[model samples]
Target chain A: MITFLFYLPFILGFVVIGVWGERKIASFIQDRYGPMEVGPKGLLQTIADLLKMLQKEDIRPKAADKPLFLMAPLLIFVAIFAGFAVLPISPAISGADIETGVFFLLAVVSLDVVGVLMAGWGSNNKYSLYGAMRSVAQIVSYEIPLGITVLCMVVIGSTLDLNELSSLQGIFTSETTYLFGIKSLGIDVTQIGGILSWNIVQVPFSFLIFLIFFIAGLAEANRAPFDLPESESELIGGYHTEYAGFRWGIFMLSEYAMMLLVSFLASILFFGGWNTPFPNIGSVTMATWTSGTPGELSGAIWGAFWLIFKTTIFVFVQMWVRWTYPRLRVDQLMSLSWKYLTPAALILLLLCGVWKMLMV
Target chain B: MDQMAVYLFYFFGLLAIAGALGILITRNLMHAAFLLIAVFLSVAAIFVLGGAEFVAVSQIMVYVGGILILLIFGIMLTNRISSDKIDTGFGNVLLGILVGCAFLVWVGDYILTQFNDQKAALEQTNNQTEKLGISLIADHVLAFELIAILLLIALIGAAYIAKKDKEEVME
Candidate 1:
């Protein structure tokens, strides 16, 4: 509950930063000033937008389904927020700490499809319906590869618990960690504890798996080149076209929050959540200094620092990809998921299974 | 914790029943679909209250996420005979009620007979997912494999049918 409360404000703050950051990044990539007026570097632009949104009249179409129209935004926000309850911030600080944390997170987050459907159908608008349908279809299709990649990690780790998964990739692991799961090589990366211990490094194939995961995560978060659902040129705001004021703000907030969630998951699964990238190179002892022992206050602080740091990097990459690439057509999007990523992910899953067997 | 579980059970159970009733009573097809999601969710909650977290999550993922979305998509794409509501014309009312009553009675009797045994088994179970996995692989491997093959066949058949339909449209 405490973690949940903490995340609520964190998400809100992240949205304020994320919106401004996205605009600035987009501008910089295009060689233009982003937001310069509001609060030095336009930091207060999102805040100003929020205040303006709050005061705007909540408009509803006369033909709209009143109950569903009113409930859709709340449902979308709540469903997305519920996913954070299972995500561990650090070794010492986590939300639910459930054994089925990863599975539960995936399940809860997918409920937003229902909310999106509600928003589209209840609005009784053609564009909103088209947006909702396209969004739901994209998410559902992308989830196949996304789930397969995550399953690849789960196969290698032999655990679904995110905290356990995180611990296994760092100095805190209780089991012996062989470099690339090859014992005959006679190299153990565990004690060295840095990039060597991270999942992508320990299991070399996981880098490919992580790439697939990253692409799938981008699609799942509705970021371009997969943001066809909200293609402003055609759909004009898509599912939230009928939505106005704070309701529309809620949709934007959830989109940014989803981006952050995916970044956190990517870092946690591949880059080693809350674990320092610096190795303890003999007398240097940088890894130990950076990532304090689990359960200590210093541990929590360092853990949060590294996790947030890694997450921010991934978030920036997501923004970079969004601005760099053009939006994919609907057919192109579906083909990428079903034809390309799905096959690649399935092969990775098989390879991961074999790798797990070899490690055993 | 035990008391809380009991309260949660009652809360979700009532919610499930209410949602089911709403689905039956609702005039709009979309409303009925949404009500069905509520029922599915509450039933998943009941699964959680029973200490079956894995099952609960799977229930939500497969039913609410996969199946319900497809169901809603179908509802949205279909041309409605009416403007707002999909008219549900009733037929064979007496036979429908009789069959429903008989099934309810049979299920109620079965649950009554097995309740105590199931409760005892549930209490003894811990780390249900691990145990479930072991049993599925070691004890019921044949059944699991058979189900997987069945689903694969069904998927292929559906794909073939869809492809044929598209080819027909193209011609």
Candidate 2:
């Protein structure tokens, strides 16, 4: 419940900063100033937008399915928000301490497809239906590779608990950690304790897995390059085309929250989540100073700092890719998932199994 | 805590039944499909209450996420059924009620007879996923392998049928 409260405000605040940041970044990319009038280089621009949105009358189309249409935004928000319940904010703080935290998060987030379908069908608009269908298809298709990539990490980590996964990749782990997870090399990086012990460094092939996970995550979040669902050039505003006022705001909020959720998962899975990146060298205790033992208040603070730091970097990359690339054609999107990503993820899964065997 | 668990169990059990009834009565196919999701979710909740977290998550993932989406897609793509109202013809109402009542009675009888035994067995278990995994690999390996092969064959058959239809369309 505490984590729930923290995430609600956290998501709202992140969306505010994210919207402003995206605009500023896009403007800079196009050689122009973005939103300089609002408070402090337009930091309060989203708040202004929110106030304007709140005052606008909520409109429902005559032909729309009234209950489903009204229910769609709330359902979408709830489904996405539920994914955060399993997110380990810090070692001491997690929403639900379920043994299958990773799987539960994946399962809960995928429920948003039902909400998307409701929005599309209930709107009684052709464009909205098209957008929703495309969105669901893309999400469902991409989830295969996403699930496979995550399964690869699970195989390597041998645990589905996010907190346990975090501990395994940090200095606190008691087990011997080999370079690239090959026991023959016998260079234990457990004591070194930094990026060296991270999954990407410990299991080099997982870098490729991370890339697959990132791409799948992007598609799942409905961000650009895979934003065919909301391609404004053709589909108008997509699934939420019939929505107005704060309902539209809910969709936008869910999108940003989904972005943060994916970024957090990626960092935790591959980047030694909440663990400091600086290794302890001779006469230097950067790792120890940066990260405390789990359950300590200092640990929670430092953990959140590093996790948010990595997540911010990923979020920036997502925005960068969004602005840089053109939206994928429908066929191109399907082919990328079924032909390329899924097959690659499968092979990577097999390789990860071998890596796990070697580690054992 | 145990009282809370009992209340949750009853709540989800009633929710599942209500959702199923909603699906039966709804004239709109889309609304029925959505109500089916409610049923699936409540059943998952019931699984959670039973201490089967792995099964509960899988229930949501497979039923709510995969199968229900496919069902919705089927409804959407079918021009005839996509209309606002579906007849869902009322045939053999008496027979349906008879079968339903008999099945309910049988299930109730079995539950009443075996409840204490099952409760005692369940109380001894923890980390259901690990136990499930070990049993799947060690005791039920053949059954697991057979199911996997069956699913793989079904997937290939589906792809083949879909591809054949695509080729016919092109021709």
Candidate 3:
């Protein structure tokens, strides 16, 4: 019920914000104010962009797969929007807070690959086909490390519930410290890693894995660096190069929508999701969590307010990353993943796993 | 009045069932792919009526998005000649239709009577994504890992094949 409303606003918000982010990113990089002429500091840039795309033509090439050509855009939009069923947008502001939320998010998210493949295949252009194949290979290769890193988080977190992980069951203090039966005055490893022992902070090596995973995600989602699929400079609007109108808009919007979804996932898995770094900056009674029958608002339906607040902060961090980075070359991109990221992540996984076993 | 709603339900049910059978009976492989898309879209509608919005979206996404593309690509990459266009003869078509009709009749009877005909009976559908995720992690974790192995094998095989062509060209 409330989840549907959250899904709608969340999608529309990402679609609109993404366009603005893109314009702002361009201007910031070039040292000139982009879109300033469109609205108050180019706020209406997305609106103009939308209208422009709307008036454009819808051209299907003669040699393309008819059914699939038409199906590509719709499928991209569908898969991107579908992951919203599990994101914790607000305390009382999500669709279903399902237990297996994390896994579901990943499954629906991978479905975006199909849309990319279709856009490439259905275009019947050599560049689009090549770009599509390349995109799939890069995305699939990156997924292994991304997934392994995520699995590391899941192993530590134990439960797949986003909200549960966000609450931080693993917090430890100096008084409670035990390192082979010695309590230290200053060093609390729990404070360093927490209960789920965030993969990034627990091992210095995991940072490389995190960086690789983030970059790979950026590429897989066709957000610059790996955006050769839509490389306007060379392929002239690669993959869906010939697409026009709402279909093109949907593809672009799906990209932004997925960026948001993936960032939310990143936050959940690594950044303690919605856990306030400082404890008790917010706290709710179990009654509120189980509100309908109780003394607090746990079930009070507004219990998600804190959850949404933390998740959004993580989502914003993702936007910050997107605007900050420049594009990557194709060969460089493959090397970065295969030569550097993948091997590093595998080693981290193995070492961390063994270390975990030793400690236990 | 209640019977009227049941009849209305049967009308759309007929549309879905008949469409599916038409797909099975179609002679053209390309035509069959189109029919399957129709079947998938209709099943999505059914998933909606069954109160599984998420599953409905996934069914539409996976079947309509992924599998249909694969089927069409299979059709494209293969050189389809007259052999692929051969039709089942009249007697064979008649016999096939009779068998299909019998199967449908039996299934329809089962749907009406033996399944306890309860409105709530429609709710056994799992959250499609979650169920799939659980199976990936818990029951089929090995199989899921095997998917990785399979993909790696495919990538290598494709690379080897492509390399052989390159070597031939160089020679």
Candidate 1 per-residue lDDT, tens place, A1-360, comes to: 845677888888989998999999999999999999999999999899899999999999998888888889889888888888877777787668576888888998999989988998888888888899899999999999999999999888888888888888888788888777687798877777888888988888798999999999998888898988889999997888898898999999899889988998999899998888998888998889998877888998899899889999999999999999999988899889989999999999999998888774
Model 2 per-residue lDDT tens digits across residues B1-171: 289999999999999999999988888878999999999999999888877789999999999999999999998887642266444667899999999999999999988986856675445256777788889999999999999999999998997877756567898
**Candidate 3 lDDT tens digits, A1-360:** 555676667667767866786677667866987778787888888888888888888877777767767888887778677777776543333346554566566656666666776677677777776677667667766766776776666655555666555443224212232222123323444533232243344433555656756776676677765676677777777778768788888888787777776667666566544333332212533322331321234422333443345446645555566567666777787778877877887776776666556543
Residue A341 in model 1: lDDT: 97
The CAPRI category of model 3 is: incorrect
TM-score for candidate 1, residues paired by index: 0.97
lDDT of 1 at A77: 82
Can you give the TM-score per candidate against the true fold? Answer: 0.97, 0.97, 0.67
Per-residue accuracy of model 2 over A224-342 as CA lDDT, tens digit each: 99999999999998999999999999999999999999999999999988888998786697888899877899988998899999999999999999989999999999999999999
Candidates, ranked, DockQ: 2, 1, 3
Best by DockQ: 2
lDDT-better candidate, 2 vs 3: 2
Q: Backbone clashes per model, in order?
A: 0, 0, 18
